[model samples]
Target: MSQNWKFFKESVRHFWQVGSLVQSSRYLVDSLLADVDFAESRLIVEFGAGNGCVTRELLRRMRPDARLFSFELSQVFHEEISSIAARDPRLTAVHGCAMLAAQMFAAQSVDCVVSGLPMGNFGKCAKLGVLSTVHAVLKPGGHFSQFQYSLLDYRLMKRHFPAVRLGYTPLNFPPAFVYNCVSA
Candidate 1:
């Protein structure tokens, strides 16, 4: 399909940032959102919207009034997400870095932050900056769900979040570990 092609091409071009050559499997997306209460979460932020697979799923599940700000650094992926945002009033596709989340939104304004970023590929400063920004925007008790090919940034996440729960999904392109961390 066209989706697969775009994902593959983009991944090949930006492997370190995009992470995978295929879009996330439905199983992986479900596992990442399993603990999130979409109905109760009014404001959501998605880091590394990539090809918009997870963004579409979040739009489908979130409440009518819920708002989704999907941040994508890649131009191709950002355009893809922007097109989807054009059709969905609730989605705000942002072409920027995840580390700037705090600048884009008010502190304690987000109910949750979901990410498909390749944290393992990020340098320590980038990892910490993004995590801290995510934490700053999230409301108390808000959740941050991120999936990675490995537990590369597990310790970093634990340092920023008060509680971090880990899970795994074997049905993805490459099986992934999902971290569900809650802001204190």
Candidate 2:
């Protein structure tokens, strides 16, 4: 009962600040996968997989040998992810900060990184730390994709990646811009 309340409140709090917005038609789970090519990836990592929305899609598209590691902070959301994590050997639910990604994953090990984290909520230091860690874990040609409410960081993505591609999903409530980045 208390757990449910915690989930509800946390969802509400972060939703307004950063949670999945149905009005914007943005459900972190599904939208993130619309453009992914699962055949090109075997080891996938997800940053800030809230409510396993995109997580589930990754699992669904994965090859039989594929593995998924998702990082989530909220205990409530963590628990939600764990519910499915335990059922699938391919899914590893990591309860920790996104900044620790490189430590948790082997160097140059990930093929694709899909983040649901709201960079808008974090400071510049945090964005750099987390993105650096992402660069550390990504293979030389690995891709990084993240969505934001605005186009404030296309240049930042360019600095971090060799190439950056932009796409928009107006279906999401308030609309969203997806940044598709790859290591140079």
Candidate 3:
């Protein structure tokens, strides 16, 4: 919780630009990856992919035909994702709000959406906007994966996804829960 200034500033910059927080621990990385059901996916999108940490991991784990569309608002992080995106045909980093997920992406087009944004950080209106868009973009049987700092959003999550499972990661700084927000 008591993060260094340099790292903290860098994280804020990346997040202000990209919409995600930085995770310094390798254990956090492993936990995020383990919860993802990548084997059945072809179209993958990441919301709030800051600095491309999870995006890079998604690239490494995804199948050959899978395409990744990463949405980050921060220009700094967008440039970072773009720099790497150019090297691979499967990747694309879009500078936009995840709240516009429906219009930005074709309806029911995504097979999986892995979110890194802190949904709890948003206001009720803004939070609902992003959730609605997420629901519209995912195909039936598609999974919307996200991790949270606590189980505070459990009720709303169940309303959004057909199935929602809670798992703990004490290894994460301050400890966190990975919510597999699966759609009906």
Q: Which candidate is the best by lDDT?
A: 1
Q: Which is better, 1 or 2, measured by lDDT?
A: 1
Error of 2 at 6 (Å): 8.6
Off by over 4 Å in 2: 1-8, 14-31
Put down candidate 1 lDDT per residue, 32-64, tens digits, no spaces: 898788879999999999999899999999999
Question: What are the runs in model 3 whose C-alpha is more than 4 Å off?
Answer: 1-7, 12-21
The collision pairs in model 1 are: none
The most accurate candidate by TM-score is: 1
Per-prediction TM-score:
0.96, 0.87, 0.86
Where does candidate 1 stray beyond 4 Å? none
Q: Candidate 3 lDDT, tens digit per residue, 1-184?
A: 2323433566675544322344525555566667567788899888987667788888999998899999987676678789879988899889888876788778998898888777767778977887888889998888887777778777888888778877678876657777777787
Q: Give the root-mean-square deviation of each candidate in angstroms.
A: 1.1, 3.2, 3.4
lDDT of 2 by residue, 78-105 (tens): 8978998988889999988877788888
The Cα RMSD in angstroms, rounded to one decimal, for candidate 2 relative to the true structure is 3.2
